[model samples]
Target: MISYVKGPLVDIFEDTVIIEAGYIGLEIHVPLSVLDRLPGIGMETILYTYFQVREDGMCLYGFLNRQDLRMFKQLISVSGIGPKGALGVLSAMTPDDLRVAIISGDAKAISRAPGIGVKTAQRVILDLKDKIDMADVLPAQFAAAEGPEISAGGVAKEAIEALVALGYSQTEANRAVGKVEVSDDMTSEDVLKASLKHLAFL
Candidate 1:
C-alpha cells in the first residue's frame, strides 16, 4: 500500500493533482481543501495517502494532513459510504468541523454535504459519534471566515474547466468556486485564484 508521497506538483485542477516522483506522475484525487493548499506547478509537496482497489482499477486519495486522512478512512468505513461519498463529506467540511457535527449530532450540517441526505447524515453521526475524539478535531474558532484569498485575474472559467478535467462533478466545482467574492474587477483568473483558496474550506 502507498502510505505517502513526496514529489513535485505538476498539475492542479478542481479535485485532483498530479505529483511527479521517481520520473512518474501520480494522479491523486483530493478534496477542495488540499487543492487550495497546492502550490503552483513545480512546487514540492508531500501527502498522506490512502489507496482504494476495486475490480476495475486502483485509485489514490490524498490529504494535506494525517488527521484528514484518518477522517477519510473513518468515513469510508461507514455502510454505503464509498471513496467518492467520503470525499464529498470531506469536501464540505473540515475534519474538525466534521467531528464536532458528529459529536453534537448535527445532522443538518452533515446533510449539507452534496448528495448526503438526512438519513445518511444521521447514520454517520450515530456510527462515528463515539469513535472520534472531538477535542482532537475541532478547531478553536468555529466561526472563522471561509473561502480562498482572491486576486486580480480573468481565469475563473479556465480554472473551472481545469477542475472539470480533473474529474470533479460540475456541481462540486461550481460550489467550490461560488464561495469566492466575485466583483466587476474580478476576471476568470481572479475567480480561479479565489476558487483555489475557497476549495480549501471544504
Candidate 2:
C-alpha cells in the first residue's frame, strides 16, 4: 500500500536500502543504478516504491523515478519475470535503454542481465514491445541533438513530440522533422506542417 518512502537513509547494502520513516526502518530492494545515485548514509532519501506480498514474506522495491518504477511493473507483468528478475533487468540497463532495446527488438541486449536468458529476454520483448512507445526510446538522443533532429530547441522538439502524439513512431518523426528546413523564427506548428509533408516521403 505504500507509494513511496521519504526519510533519512539508515543504511545502504549491496542491493537494499533502509530508510527510516516515523521510527520504522523499511528495507527496500533497488537496482544497482539507484545505489550509484543515493546520498551518503543518513542523508534524506526518497524513493518511489512497489510493495509485494508473498506467502513467505513481504518486500518493497524502489526506484529513483516513476519511469523506472513503471518499467519494473511492466517487466514483472511478463510471464517468466518476477520482481527480482525485473530488478536485475533495470540494473543491467537504464529504463530508456531498455525501451530502445524493446523497440528495436534487441533481445541480446536484455539477455545480458544477471539471470535472464535468451528465451526469457525474447519473451520480455514480445510481451512489452507493444506496451511501450518508440517516443520514450531515445529522449536523451533527441535532447542532445545526436539524432536526425539537429536541434533540441522548441520547434524541432515539439514537432517530434507532436508527431509521436499523432501515433507515428519516433523514428518516423525524427526522419520527417530532420528533412524539413526549419528557420529560426519558425513555430512548432510551422515545423510540424512542413514535417508532415516530409513524413509522406519517409
Candidate 3:
C-alpha cells in the first residue's frame, strides 16, 4: 500500500494532479476540498493517498488532510455508497454538516446532492450516524452561480476536449473546472488536476 507521496506538483487542474517524484509522474485523484487547499503548480506538496485495486484498473485517491481521508473512508463504508458517490456527498456538504444532518435526520438536505435520492439519503444517515462526529463536519460551500468558460486557446481547450472524449458532458467538465478555480495559465496537465476536483462536485 502506498501511504503517501511527497514531490513536486508538476500539474494542477480541477480533479487530478501529476506529482513528479524521482523522474516519474504519478497521477493522483483529488476532491474539491483538497484542490482548494493546494499551492500553485511547480511547487512541492504532500498528499495522503488511498489506493483502490480492481481487476480492470487501479485508482489512487489523494487527500490534503487525514480528516478528509477518514471522512471518505467512513462514507464509502455505507451500503450503496461507492467512491464516486462518497465524493459527491463530500463535494456538496462539509463533513461536519453531513454528520449533523445525519444525526438530526435531515434527509432532504442530504438528498440535495446531484445523484443522491431521498431513500439513499436516509440510508446514508442511518448507516453513518454512529461513525462520524456531529461536531466536526462543517457546512459545505457551494460554488458561486457562474457559468464556466474554457479559455479561448491552448491546453485548456485540449483538456476540455479530453474530458469530453473521456465521457464527461461538456457542462459537467466546465462546472468541474469552474469549481476548482483553475486559472488560464495552466496546461492540459493542470486542467486534468482541476477536472478531478470538479468531477467530485458531480
Query: Could you give me the TM-score of model 3 versus the true structure?
Result: 0.63
Q: For model 1, what is the C-alpha lDDT against the true structure?
A: 0.75
**lDDT (C-alpha, whole model) for all candidates:** 0.75, 0.82, 0.70
Sorted by TM-score (best first), the order is 2, 1, 3
Per lDDT, what order, best first?
Answer: 2, 1, 3
Most accurate candidate by lDDT = 2
| Candidate 1 lDDT, 44-132, residue by residue in tens | 99999999999999999999988889889999988988999999898898776787577556788889999899999989988897788
Which stretches in model 3 have alpha-carbon errors above 4 Å?
134-202
Against the hidden true structure, what lDDT does model 3 obtain? Answer: 0.70
Better of 1 and 3 by TM-score: 1
| Candidate 1: C-alpha RMSD after superposition | 13.9
TM-score for each of the candidates:
0.67, 0.70, 0.63
Error of 3 at 154 (Å): 60
Task: For residue 76, give model 1's deviation from the true position in Å.
Answer: 0.6
Model 2 segments beyond 4 Å from truth? 140-202
